[model samples]
Target chain A: MDAPAIYRIALDVMGGDNAPVALLEGARAALQAHPELFLHLVGDEDRLRPLLAHTGLKGELASRFAIVHAASVVDMDDKATSILKEKKDSSIRVAAQLVREGKADGVVSMGHTGAAMVASKMVLGTLSGVDRPCLAAILPNMQGRPTVLLDVGANIDCRPDQIAQFAIMGSIYAEGVLGIPGPRVGVLSVGEEEGKGSTTTREAAEALKDIDLNFAGNAEGRDIWNGKFDVIACDGFVGNALLKSAEALAEGLVQGMKGVFKENLLTKLAALLTLNGLKRFAARLDYAEYGGAPLLGVKGVSIIGHGRSNAKAVHSAIRAALMASEHRVNDQIQASLGRLMSQAGSQETS
Target chain B: MDAPAIYRIALDVMGGDNAPVALLEGARAALQAHPELFLHLVGDEDRLRPLLAHTGLKGELASRFAIVHAASVVDMDDKATSILKEKKDSSIRVAAQLVREGKADGVVSMGHTGAAMVASKMVLGTLSGVDRPCLAAILPNMQGRPTVLLDVGANIDCRPDQIAQFAIMGSIYAEGVLGIPGPRVGVLSVGEEEGKGSTTTREAAEALKDIDLNFAGNAEGRDIWNGKFDVIACDGFVGNALLKSAEALAEGLVQGMKGVFKENLLTKLAALLTLNGLKRFAARLDYAEYGGAPLLGVKGVSIIGHGRSNAKAVHSAIRAALMASEHRVNDQIQASLGRLMSQAGSQETS
Candidate 1:
């Protein structure tokens, strides 16, 4: 299969709550599946060597993956500001630096979201014309495809200009990666009607309407999974809440069903018969199914996996990183942003 | 039991996508179930007569549910602003007026949400010290207990004072009505950190930290459905979006499961066996399960049901109204607001 388009994904080995083990296992899984894939495990060499030795890899497989010793690892519980200020040699910071230095195609981290965002921002910097980098999470819709929601946890207090830019980035990601045509972008608001939002949303909606993108005016939160819009735009705070709420609800429902279905003989029988369907449903809702959230608006490809990610989640995250890097999401974002700004300028003059 | 607490819930008979059919049937469901429950159906007499005839209701039900001719109905497709300005004598306005004039114990309208908000504001008025009214919805958690979220769609532009009041109202509703003891109230923000939100949120969080209630610092969107907090507060604009997104996700999951499970013959058999569990899961996530969203800052008992509500939803909404009325939500809100204002006063001085 033409060597599966070899991509080197840098992994922050000591990031998430389930650190090196999950990270090391994930790297192993990715490497086993894609023979051409290379992994740069960024962490203390001593800690990783023992874990890697257990993988029992030989020859080329071992050579393909290497540990780049980092002085420290950013703890998942550390404060974002403190981590950014103090943890320069942390695994997350070093991993991000690898992408910036052209040593890796992308960097994936299961670190504190804020820490990962901060390190990625500091090391790789935001793309030109992008003020802040937004974390875009892909939510599975009924169509079996995914919708990209931006600024899920990045910049909570955003201006209209920033949200407008977020829409552009989200649109590009959805189209460039997800393969949606002429993506419908909607600004998240209270109602679908015009002028039905905060000062920032209202202003962003006005600006978005003038842009060349397939702007669908204001969309309520219900519109996110309704397949009404391909790209849902909002300030990071709202987007983060929506993303998390959706995930939590799905997880809750799945858990609740498991409990309810096992309480009786009839339900147990039902559970057995519905097992495949339930598995499919769980897979559809599983965050691991989609891999990771892309840190859009950044200069380089950076993916943020969940804080509690296991090997499977980390593996999916690496796959997501490969996909994002292949799609050239940043290039599409910058091009779209330029078009949006020019459209706004023309509207002001006309 | 004890005359079932007579509650004259004013119904917007001609509101919603289903019009009088759903509204009329919903009123009948409540009225028939509880003999003490009376419905003041607000809409044109000419249109209502035939609709009632179709229900084949007895003379007792016909007499118990009175049709108050409002001469106009708010179309579901109409703009909120146009509905407010043009439909002066609309069912929503008249229904809200019933609560204002004490003709009805509460008003339940399944019409344009913005129109409902405006009508409730103008007719019912805000609780004495409330600067703005908030639309509060109950989001079902994994634990099966619902969490009340305020500012679902009332005031888009909110100040710190308003959000602080929302927190208080949300707390009271959660405690007094939802039956949570000293409900944990949280301000919805991007981060769990204290000083991480917009200007309004920062001020609101600071104000909330000192409240007598069990104020949990900051909850992200994921925490809303996690049942970690009894009440999650935010500006109406963001609250509405979060509420909608959560609702949409739940609805989408249910719909997706139904379609997927019923897709094949084998799956259909599985669906039948798992039907009870699915139904229970549906009920748990159903918006109608809790009845209606309460207008938090309003003086009177004002519950705004979904615009597309059916008979069961309307019935549940009426029940919600009764609960709110019994709890004296308005009085509690007023008392809470007074405390909040004084607390802010002390903070300002310090």
Candidate 2:
């Protein structure tokens, strides 16, 4: 069966809050676990070489990993336009180039989100029939399955048509990666009613209703954790902010619970007893559990991790990148986009 | 001075999922707690009259409360425009009327949010120079103090100028109600950078920078729970969706934790021990703890509660209404509006 297509992933070793070291450890761990992986560490050789040597990789596994040298850095402060022109040698840029040059099947970056997105857009370009690329996350729902939300900070201001595209891409990701068949797509709005949102959303909702997928009309914020839909399409501005806020709320509750347990002797004992249970519950809401948000609509897989990501998060991102590429998500997206666009064109002409 | 300006609140007893019974119990509880409050229950006299008598209210405390009958109903499905024109005797409309006639200082409704908001807008009208009425919620931030978020489900689409107005109203609410001397106001966006949002927010931020308030610039979703700003303003569509999403996240986490504790014998024992601690932490994130979201930019106090609110929530809503009126929040908003509008206008011309 063609040996399962050895997935070569370009690891942006110099990205994230904890670079070089965390990336080295995470890459080693991922490579150790996955036999069909060949990781190309894209970063400054001087920084990555020492960390990789010290991470205790066996000789056999080490043979599958290689380092690609490039010194330029894309700081979180680097503007997208500036990264495109000035930071050509940035790790994120080089990682994307690996995919463009056919050296890698996917790229994983935890650095400047905009920088990574811009680099991927310019280097790999977008898939067929896709205009702008977007970010999509798999959020854990109450039903024990994950819901996919797209445009999570890839574009600050989204056109109604873009939202329609998001639904298609998000739906594809759900079906291709999460194994959800014909994912129920929903438009994020203040109300479930057709006419109950901003002009952009109302227009998007109308357009979504016209699409051929399993559209769930409009969904409220409460529907997020309630597992109301398989994929929720929204503008980047709202999607990014909402996800972060929900994370903060969940974290605050966990911390507050910790504080409550520390209040007295009796509670302290209880906290120890239920520590495993609390951890299990927190695992449900942890974004790190899903690895990273995937940069969809692009030509190849690019997973964007948190700036504060640790080795565990990095490991998950690598896993996600492999899954996406192995599933041939881009090919699936290309086919789906062709069908939806033709239908949209017919509607427009009518 | 002048008998401390007694706060008389009219509550729509027929509103909410629990209806007249919850309202009767809540009104009684509020009256018992605050001798300064005089409640006028507005609903069908047939439903409210018996509930109040059966709840075991003494003759003297009962003197502080009265029932006003209103037959016309604003069904949750009823359109806002239709409710404005036809439902003249609806409880929400009647309660709002009591405020306009100076018979009550504030009105509380847990019924159809849009209908209640429309009724308040039409009956009480807006304060002088106020272009739109907005909803402001005191969300609990990680710092233990509340963060004021405005235009939450009030206006789906807001102009840049309207955002400026939201900042003014929200600022006044923080100072007049929460007693913050000069609250730091922020425009909720996708990023914390200057030019990091949509055209609407960029314009709003630019105009805000020209004004006198302590504008905290753009705040991402993380800032909501990080307690970065005391007040965050946004278009109602975004604010409502984000808030509901955060709420769902918190509730989900709480429920998830409960499930974890039910796993086995060890977890069951731990659950019993940490149950109190979990309850305490959950209360910190509870929306009902803060009562209701205030309808700011209006002439009189209007508190919008959840349809599923219990007696405690109803009681808290009444308490918030009393505090807003007692502090003369509308007067504070009126004075602040004049200053902001002139500043916004001057910026436009320049």
Candidate 3:
């Protein structure tokens, strides 16, 4: 039916803990899964070329991929803005450049999150009317549908207007990409009441009311996965804490369960019986399932994954990039922001 | 052993989800567990007298407890400062007033947290140099030792000085009450690096260096339960988000496991085999085990438990209040703040 539209993604091969090997394998998996997918492998050609050879792609499939050599790699400790000046030829920068130059539809990197955000913002620029770009993470909720939580770790300190901008971007991303119709947007706070959080949060809640969205007042931290709001917007500092703590808790619980199962023969037998169910449970909480968090408000699709991302995670990230590009999320975001600005402008005149 | 010293706690029996029933049971449990404990049951005398009869505390033990009647109850939806003028006769206020009047050593309430904080601060007032009171929650970490997380929801907008003060108070609480020697204190940030967080966090980190404690630079959200630091401090907004998110995740995971076990007959049998281990796991993550969070920096002990607290949680909260009172946490906090102020004064003169 209407032959699948070709989607191209620039892959930062030399990023994340798994690096080129996991990324190369993920690229292969994505290519195998989607016939219309193409990848620009951005990394050291010497390292990637050999890895590409071992990926076992035949003539037609092999034509779907190419290596774009990058001289440097951004270290985890590198300053977020260092890629702009110091490590200009870094894989993350080169990958974003591919998107900027229209050589690829999107970019995917499981690298230094700060570096990825900086590179994407500097290279592709922000969507029209958007000030600062924010990161939006798709979390699996009890409702089985995904909830989008934004500004996970981008802008540490945000003004009321920026929080409002984040809400609009998050709503658009949720509806346009996550397919949640009329996404319910809520500002994260200490309590669900309008004036129950910090002064910034209170102002943010007020700002959110003036926006053109199905704004659901304030959401508490527990509401993140309680299947209440489709989109929850928070400042990066708070959002980052929640995201990291949730991830660590899930990981720790999984590890604790493993320890529990290994305690005795009877428990071991119980583990065997409940293996599939437990695996499904863990999968629900797994970051790899969601793949990467999209750097929203950027002019182009830029998916940033966890540093500890695996082959499966990389594959999911590429798929996310493809979906974001296909859905034209940035276009929707720009249109939404334009509408908001015009509304404010009209209100001022009145 | 030397005769146990009497520790009197003013209990807000009308607070929490379970109200009088759970509070009565908890008071009984606490009284049974601690021979020298006394409770000033603060609520409507009519409701209390009947419930206290069924508690089975008799003769000398019965004489140890007394009903301190209050006419009004603080509703969950009431304004935090309403108890100051509007609902002055509220159970929570009565409990705190008992402490202020020297009738009780501490106050315990499973009521609106903000109200409890307001009442404690207004009635007992802040310790000598503590300008604001902060909440310190004891979280069970992977290392088997408890980590103290402060400002969970007390002061939403904290200054650099206030955060530094929270660190000092948290360190004291961890050392004095939790019994950790020379508690490792940390400022909660997005990263462990000194310059990695927001302006306030960076400033707090700087302020922490001049304080007299084992300052551990910066601690991330995961560090709350990773057992990295003995005490972690953050603004109430961020800390609340982290605390609530962690609690929800642990709860959601437990529910997920229960669902998995109930899925099939085989899984049910498996659950039967691993019931004890699962219970232990759940217990480890249970808030009942920790009981309550202390409102540190106040002139007297004020413990705030969850609204959903059961008899066990209330009992634990009473025990926490007793420990806090017994250890003279306020004296230690005042001494710490006094030393810091004098140090600052000397530095200014120099």
| Winning candidate number (DockQ) | 3
Write candidate 3's Cα lDDT for A126-166 as tens digits: 88899899999889887677888889998899997788889
In candidate 2, the residue pairs with backbone N, CA or C atoms under 3 Å apart (3 or more residues apart, or in different chains) clash, namely none
- Candidate 1: which stretches are off by over 4 Å? A1-7, A32-37, A50-57, A82-86, A209-212, A310-312, A331-350, B1-7, B17-38, B46-65, B82-85, B339-350
TM-score-superior candidate, 1 or 2: 2
Prediction RMSDs, each to the true structure: 3.7, 2.6, 2.5
Positional deviation of A286 in candidate 1, in angstroms? Answer: 4.0
Instruction: State the lDDT of candidate 1 residue by residue for B1-350, as single tens digits.
Output: 56556668788877777778887777777877777677888998898887786775557687787888898877767666554578888888888888888999888888877778778888887788888778888877877788888887777778886888888888888877778899988888877888887787889888777668798888888888888988888887788777777777777777766766776787777678777777777777777777778887786888887876877888888877777777777787788788767777887899
Estimate, for each residue in B43-63, the C-alpha lDDT of model 2 and write its tens digit: 998866777777755578878
Q: Where is the poorest 10-residue window by lDDT in model 1 chain A? A: A51-60
- Off by more than 4 A, model 2: A1-4, A50-56, A76-82, A346-350, B1-4, B53-56, B72-82, B85-87, B263-268, B342-350
Better of 2 and 3 by lDDT: 3
Supply the TM-score for candidate 1.
0.89
Can you give the TM-score per candidate against the true fold?
0.89, 0.93, 0.95
- TM-score leader: 3
Residue A260, candidate 2: Cα error in Å is 2.4
Query: Candidate 3 on B53-153: residue-level lDDT in tens?
Result: 67664656787798988999989889999999989999999999989999899999998888999999899988889978999888988776788998898
